[model samples]
Target: MAKGYKQMLAEADALVVSVTAEEMAGKLEDDSIVLVDIRDPRELEREGMIPGARHAPRGMLEFWIDPESPYHKPWFAEDKIYVFYCASGWRSLLATRVAQEMGLDAQNLRGGFSGWKKDGHPTAVKEKRRT
Candidate 1:
């Protein structure tokens, strides 16, 4: 039998550390932390993201994190606490686990962007990138 989404989420959850929106909000001013939003472009356009969060779409995450990959993002090489979030917490939980395995100090945003909005945290509209 193949592992289902639930099994994957459970495995990821057990391995990754998750921080609540309130806790994350307190770290907004912390320079040592890096907020990473791992959602689709459409989702970001429809719903704004956390202020100061860097957009790293989920599909390209592995490539972006791998230093040897041509798609590697230099920021991912920085020595900072990376907090990954999606619209909901599920995607981020899995992403966090992969990041952690890749040797980054990564954590998941509990309840994700929805939770952050519900908690009244500040958000900023993402301008469409010119490719």
Candidate 2:
């Protein structure tokens, strides 16, 4: 027998905190909360992201968070609470779980960026990065 994506997602969801768009919006002004967007660049180009959110592609997350890793990002060591979001929350859920296991204060947005936009939340576009 083999486990599937749904089972993995369920397990991650059980362990990760899921915050609603409204809750996240309330925390926007909190200096201790850092909203993280984990979608790929193409997705971001197709859809805007939460304002002031930091972009950390899903692929580089673990490396960026590990202090011992040469790719470690200083922000990962900050005292802020990280709230991750993807297009529809799936990737973010798994990301939250992994981040927590790596000793981060992390949570996933319940409905992700799509839900946030649907709920009329504020969005911002990132400047294109040179390749």
lDDT of each: 0.96, 0.94
lDDT of 2 at 79: 88
Candidate 2 C-alpha lDDT tens digits along 1-131: 89998999999999988999999998898999999999998888778789989999999999999999999999999988999999999999999999999999999999999999999999998667778
Candidate 1: Cα lDDT at 49: 97
| lDDT agreement of model 1 with the native | 0.96
Tens-digit per-residue lDDT, 22-71, candidate 1? 99999998999999999999899889999999999999999999999999
Total clashing pairs for each candidate: 0, 0
CA displacement after TM-score superposition, residue 103 of candidate 2 (Å): 0.3
Query: Which ten residues in a row are the worst by lDDT in model 1?
Result: 122-131
What's model 2's overall lDDT? 0.94
Give each model a TM-score. Answer: 0.96, 0.96
Candidate 1 ranges beyond 4 A from true positions: 129-131
